[model samples]
Target chain A: MSIGLKKARAVIRATLSKGREMGLSPLSVVVLDPGGHVVAFEREDGAAPGRFAIAHGKAFGAVMLGMPGSAQMARAEGQAYFMGAMNGLFGGQVVPVPGGVLMRDGRGRLAGAVGVTGDTSENDAEAAVAGVEAAKLVAEA
Target chain B: MSIGLKKARAVIRATLSKGREMGLSPLSVVVLDPGGHVVAFEREDGAAPGRFAIAHGKAFGAVMLGMPGSAQMARAEGQAYFMGAMNGLFGGQVVPVPGGVLMRDGRGRLAGAVGVTGDTSENDAEAAVAGVEAAKLVAEA
Candidate 1:
C-alpha cells in the first residue's frame, strides 16, 4: 500500500514528538513513498543543516533496497564498493545507515520508509521506530 | 529565517576583521541566503584569483544542502562519485569542504550561510564564525 500525504504528515509529527520525548537533538524527518520520492519532511528549528537531505538519503536508501536501514548498514559493511556505486547511481541520496526504517501495513504490505536525523544514528532509529508504531504501522529497522 | 542586507554586510565586515586580526592572507567572503542566493560579498585587496567563486561555492553548498561545509567534506570522502554527481547537478557549485558556515537566528532558524576563502580552511571557518557572531547570529561550522 502506498503512503498517503496524511499518513506522511502524521509520521513526521510523531517522529518529532518522539525526538522531543527522548530529549534528542532537534531533528529532521522525511517520509518517502515506496518509489523513493519525498512524501513529507520537516526540519525542526535549530536542527543541523542539510538534515532534510540526510533524512531523505536514509529513507531513500531503505526504500530503494527494500530493506530496513539497519540491514542496509550491514550490507554496506560487507559490500562497501557496491554500496558506493549505488550511492553514486542514486545521486548521493542513499545513506546506508541507521534511522531509516521501512513501514509495513498490518497485512505486511510495504507502505514507505521514515528517515530521521539530527541526533545519533541509533537515536534516530529509535525515533523513526516510535513514529511508525505511533501511526499503527510496523517498523522494520 | 532570513538575514537582512544590513546584517549581511555586518557579517562581511566581521569576517574581514578576523582575517586581518589573525594576519591571514587576503580573504574573500560570501554570504548566501537559505536559498543559496548571494546576499553580500567582499574580496579584500590582494585576494587570490577566483576567490569569489570559491567562497560562493562553499556557502552555496552549505545553504543548499542545509549542512555545514565541514560535514559535507566528511561525507564526500566516502561518497566520492556521489559527491561528484551532486557537484555536477548543481553546476559545480557544491564545494564539499570546510570554510562554509551556516547562520542561525535567535530562534534557531537558519538565517543564511557564510563562505570564506583565501586562507587555510580552518582559518576561513574561524573567520566565518566570527563574522556570524559579530552579526549577532549563531554559527554552525
Candidate 2:
C-alpha cells in the first residue's frame, strides 16, 4: 500500500505535469488499493468538484473488473447491461467509463490501480496509463 | 471472510428484527476482513447514503486496534491525533466512528469485524455486535 501511494504520487505528478504542459486544466488523481479502496488522492487547483468522486469510482472499477475502464467502455457491445448493473452492485462505487488503469508488478501481476479525471475520458485514461508506465509498474492483466 | 460476512448479515437481520419490533427505520450493515477489506455489505432501503463506507472503515479499525469503535473514539478524545492519523495513513480507510464492531471465533479469538449504520450509533454498534454473536462467534479481547 505504501509503495502504491509513493509510486502513485509520482504518477500523478508526472501525468498532471504533462496535462499542464499541454494547456490542460488541473486534474484529480486517485489511487486504490488492491482490494479497490482508496490509497491516496490529490486534487489539483481548479479541478472540477466532481472529479474526486468520479475519478475514484472509475479507478475502483478498473481494478475491481481487472481491466482499464476505457477499454471496458470501448469493448462493451451486448454486455452493456452488465456494466450498467455494476454501479448498483458496487453500491454506486463503480464507474464504467474509461480513464483508469491498473498497476502491475515486475512479474506482470496486478498490484493496484490508478485513475485520472478532469478531462475527456480518453485524456484521463491516457494520463493514468502514462503514470503507470512512468513508474515502471507493469499494467499486465 | 465468508464467515465474517455471513455472521454480519445474520447479526443485522436479528438486530433489525428487534428494531422493527421497537419501531425503527431500516439499517445498513457491513463486514470487513482483518486487513480492512470489505467482506460483505447489505443496505436496507431508506438507509443513509454511503453508510457502507463508514461501516467498513469502523469495522476495519476495530479489527486493527482490537477494540470497538466507540472505545476508540473515547480514547481519541485524549490522544486527539490517533484517529485522524490512522485515517490519513489508511488514506481515509480507517474510521473511528461508533458504527463498527469486532467479530470473534469459536476459540474466543478475533476472526474479523462488522459495522452497521443508518441508525443511532448505539444501535449500529449493537447490531454489529449482535451479528457476530449470531454467527456463534465469541469476542475475547
Candidate 3:
C-alpha cells in the first residue's frame, strides 16, 4: 500500500508542532514516498533558507537507500569516497544526518520516510519519529 | 506574502480533483514558495515515473523566473544556449513547459507557483489555473 499525501501531510504537521512545543528553532519537514518522490513538504516560518533543501535531501536519501538517515550515516562511515560518489550521482540528495526516519505500515511494509531539519540532528530525528507515531505509523530509525 | 503550506496543499488537492473530474491521466503536482523551495507536492497513483521531478522543476522555474512556465518557454525560444546554461547553472531545477503558473496574492505580491504534469500541457496548465482560482488566488500565465 502506498502512503497518501494526506497521511504525509499529517506527519509533517505533527513533526512541526512537536518541534514548536519543544521550543526548538524553526523547522522544515519533508515526506517522500517509497519511490523517493515528495509527498508533502513544509518550511516553518523563520526557518533558515537552506532548511527545506536539507530536509528534502534527508528524506529522499532515506527512501532511496531503504535505510534511516542515521543508519545510512553509520554505513557511510569510513567511506568518504563512496559517499562522495553517491552524492555526486544523486545530485547531493543524500544527507547523512539523523533527521531521516523510515516509516512502515502495520504489516511491516515500507510506507515512506519523514525528514526534519533545524535544531540538533538528534532533535530532528526525535521529531520525525514523533510525527510518524502521531500518524499511527511505525517509525524505523 | 509567502504562500503557506496549508494553502499550497489546498491548491494541489483542488488541482488533482479537477484533473479527476476531467478524466485526465494521473498527475503529479508541485508547489514552490517564493524562494523556490518546495512548499507542498503530491503524485497520484499511476502517474508516470518522472512526473514528480518534472512538476517540481516547472514550479521552481516559475517561482525563480517570476513568470509562468509557458512564458519561460516562449522567452527561451531561439535561446537554446542560454536555456542550456541556465539549466546547468541551476542543476536542472528549471523546466520550460506549459504547466507551470505563477501565483499572486490579493495585494499583488508574488506568492508562489504551482505546476502539474502527466497530461497534455494545455490541460495541465488549465488544472493549475483552476486550482489557484479555487484557492481564491490569482494564476498568472
Who wins the DockQ comparison? Answer: 3
Query: How far in Å is the alpha carbon of B30 misplaced in model 3?
Result: 1.6
* TM-scores for every candidate against the unseen true structure: 0.77, 0.51, 0.87
- Tell me how large the interface RMSD of candidate 1 is: 4.7
**Which lDDT value does model 3 have at A52?**
68
Model 2 per-residue lDDT tens digits across residues B1-141: 234333544665665565566565666665555555544445554455465577667777787777788888887887879778877877677777677777666665566777766677776666656556667776421
| Model 1: per-residue Cα lDDT over B7-33, one tens digit each | 999999999999999999999999998
| 1 or 3, greater by lDDT | 1
Pairs of residues clashing in candidate 3: none
Q: Calculate the i-RMS of every candidate, to one decimal place.
A: 4.7, 14.5, 2.2
**Which stretches of candidate 1 lie above 4 Å from their native place?**
A77-80, B17-23, B44-50, B61-97, B104-110, B133-141
Error of 2 at A73 (Å): 4.1
**Residue B135, candidate 3: C-alpha displacement in angstroms:** 2.5
lDDT, model 1, position A8: 89
CA lDDT scores, all candidates in order: 0.86, 0.67, 0.85
Give me candidate 2's TM-score against the actual structure.
Answer: 0.51
DockQ of each: 0.25, 0.03, 0.48
Instruction: Give me the overall lDDT of model 1.
Output: 0.86
Between candidates 1 and 2, the TM-score winner: 1
Give every collision pair in model 2.
A69-A98, A70-A98, B11-B131
Backbone steric clashes in candidate 2, count: 3
